[model samples]
Target: MTTDDPATDRTDREDFPDWLRQLERDIRPGPAVRLRIWCRRRSRRLMGAVGVLLVLALVAGAAAYGSGHLRRPGPAAHPAAGPAATASPTAAPGPFAGTPAAGWPAGAAGIVLPAAHRTGDFSTAQVSAGLAQVRAALLTARLDRAFMAGRSPDPLLRHFAPAARASVRKEYATETIATYATRLAPDARLAPDPPRVSGRITYQATRDNDGARKLAVTTNFVWVYGFRDPGARSGYSVVLLHDTVVWHLPYPDDVAAASRGLWLHRTSSYGWGLDCGTIHQGLVRPGGLDPAAAPFPEDPEALYDPDHPIAVPTHC
Candidate 1:
């Protein structure tokens, strides 16, 4: 439908792009929330695109809570006083709430990033599902090894909308396995392997969004990189057992889909985010943590230590 179509205007579709662009510039992590954390640095333009899409998803979700097929509920007579009188009570979902999608990440408890209060106007499930889509998109960004090898980040990037796809593709076009390997070892190189990941993500659904539930999702991941440990002190040391940080990545065997599988974003947008509570044993030293041995140029803070920071989820 053209911008002239009334139906298009109803969903704010015509205005969504403008609204989205503004939100991207303004969105920030709430209390104890992490923002702009990516493990490996990536193209800012690509990440900006990803951020826009993520927030847009949340913006759309705010409406998902309407009780009747996007229908707003009628007002109640003589509403109760105080919190009890509010349209959304903690105990009761509001007229417009949503449900979580199937197989989305859950159970990573007490990790909610504190921020503006939500009026129970939405279904916790639906908000989570919306967040899951973002996570799926992130997972695709992290796990789809094809992108790093100068291949299409499909199936992985598929989670993203069409517009997002265009942005990611451009970034991939500029990358190559040799570029990363060269960065890791200028003289003595380290072989690259798929990075493994695990962690909890939390959300803060905000009061903004003009009756929609614009929200932000925070990710805390533990990544373990595997490589052909070239037992050389000059390069990455075999300190953790084989010149690499010996840690187990979090791809669960039961997870059947590549989209949901645990992995880190190669670019420094999503995969690198960490908070105090997420450190874990076998996790590489933060000072030394970077993508594709990209940290090689910098001095490592510490080698892989089993006793190093092991992330513990913060929100109870």
Candidate 2:
């Protein structure tokens, strides 16, 4: 059976092994059906990866939304300031008919506030004008002898909000300002140079009664008073006065509307000290007398006067 029949013997030997031929057949794609089957196997893994990414993206979006980073452009917040209680929307073309100051908005516990509005960035242009108005008011209140000689201090009342006008009126009635006024007699006058910004002041957000966002501003007034002390041993007494005046400004959304809502906000409970400074007794007299050294509260700029205190008595 193992004879020398070359052709038959070669076929029996098999040049390509059975296993190698079968491997080639398996490697080659047979049809579209087989290719579809192969793709379906990997598609599950690919789909699972996409699904995981989608879940992560959804989570991130939810977090951003909760944190207010992804807030949508929605209707603006409408805050009903105290005036709304008295104001009738039907009476006016708008909610607040004439102007914001018509009734003068109030906050909780009768805290006087500007009209209900947004807060501001307080740029130089916006803040400078406000600064000027307040500065002039401050000068008139504590200084300006000629203006207050016999005239009513009511002129200064225009600058203060209606709610606080009475309280501050009492403050000017006290003897502190009176004493300061008399000391600068014989053509002595108190002069205020332009106000210069002193130091760091914080800007914090607040919610108005109507839920409108507002900004609280901390401001320092470095008031330098130039006076002629005709009676003093020294020639001229320059008083370096400092006080922290706090107010609020409305936030502006549009560039055109910037600072339109800007104003000062103050409540007796939340306002800063009217006078907080290193007491320099006399400008001409260096290392001058200390106001605290006086047996009585003798500081001219003190909020409380020893001889004449607030209408409602407060222990100094």
Candidate 3:
């Protein structure tokens, strides 16, 4: 069906080229790791093209692309006031009021663990201990004020084994710090309200190619930040980061004590509502506030749903 609206037709022609370019540049192809990522992107793009209105919707609402399915709260209806009636109480809206994150727990409280159970070689008690350490490291990396402000990530690095810590430190200098922790760009400022978070932690007993016993703790979490302007009452610009990290705990009997602590095994991440230019600088810059750098459009479920498959080629 062709639209009588010339404006809509013009928009489709203008936006498709840039959107396709941004998507291609952001996804790097690799033989072993990026094949799946490339396919997923292809499929999604095809579907969007087939549904013309969907592509238009995505382009029109680009600023909110990764901010989760934009769920603006409906206006509240008030009962007619009378001397015979009493006022009802209602909780005020929160920082995430219009996003999917509105109902998620605030900050670290959202990073919850399940009841520990035996797995492979690890007993219930061992699993609990390993998960606790992983949780602490996550809090330090993502929510620590200094770390997020681009300060040294030593606090997070220290949680890894000595050798792993050294490796991570090197990666940080090369601007790979965002893979290990969420850091704000030099120009960005978070709102007074703490970030909203939601996700899960799971663990399993596993072995490496060397056949050494280890406990693997995996965390998949999404953090949503609302940026504050100098004197604004509230921030409309939001940054959403989804990170998947696997922490490895070497068996005490399999290695020296120095190597027995938690080590970073693997990690991947993707973000929405960010200035992509700053992503290469290893910092998150909320984009909605900048007219020239509006956030890139992405599938809301792909970012907000923890059970969704982790995005690959995690460059931006």
Which parts of model 3 have CA positions greater than 4 angstroms off? 1-94, 230-234, 288-302, 312-316
Write candidate 3's Cα lDDT for 22-112 as tens digits: 7757873344444454556478786767799877788778867645445765578798886885668876455577788878888888988
RMSD of 2: 26.3
lDDT of 1 by residue, 76-110 (tens): 57855666444654553211122111122221221
State candidate 1's TM-score. 0.32
Q: 103-204, model 2: which lDDT tens digit per residue?
A: 322111112122322335445554554445555554564444454443465766666545546655565544333322211222334433221122224445
> Considering only N, C-alpha and C atoms within 3 Å, which residue pairs clash in candidate 2?
79-210, 80-210, 118-250, 118-251, 119-250, 119-251, 120-251, 248-265
- Let me know the TM-score candidate 2 reaches against the reference structure: 0.33
Alpha-carbon local distance difference test for all models: 0.34, 0.41, 0.76
The list of candidate 1 runs beyond 4 A from truth reads 1-120, 146-150, 174-198, 207-212, 229-316
Q: Each model's number of backbone clashes?
A: 28, 8, 0
Where does candidate 1 have its weakest 10-residue lDDT segment?
Answer: 239-248
- Candidate 1 vs candidate 2: the TM-score winner is 2
Q: Give the TM-score of each candidate.
A: 0.32, 0.33, 0.64
Question: Which wins on lDDT, candidate 1 or candidate 3?
Answer: 3
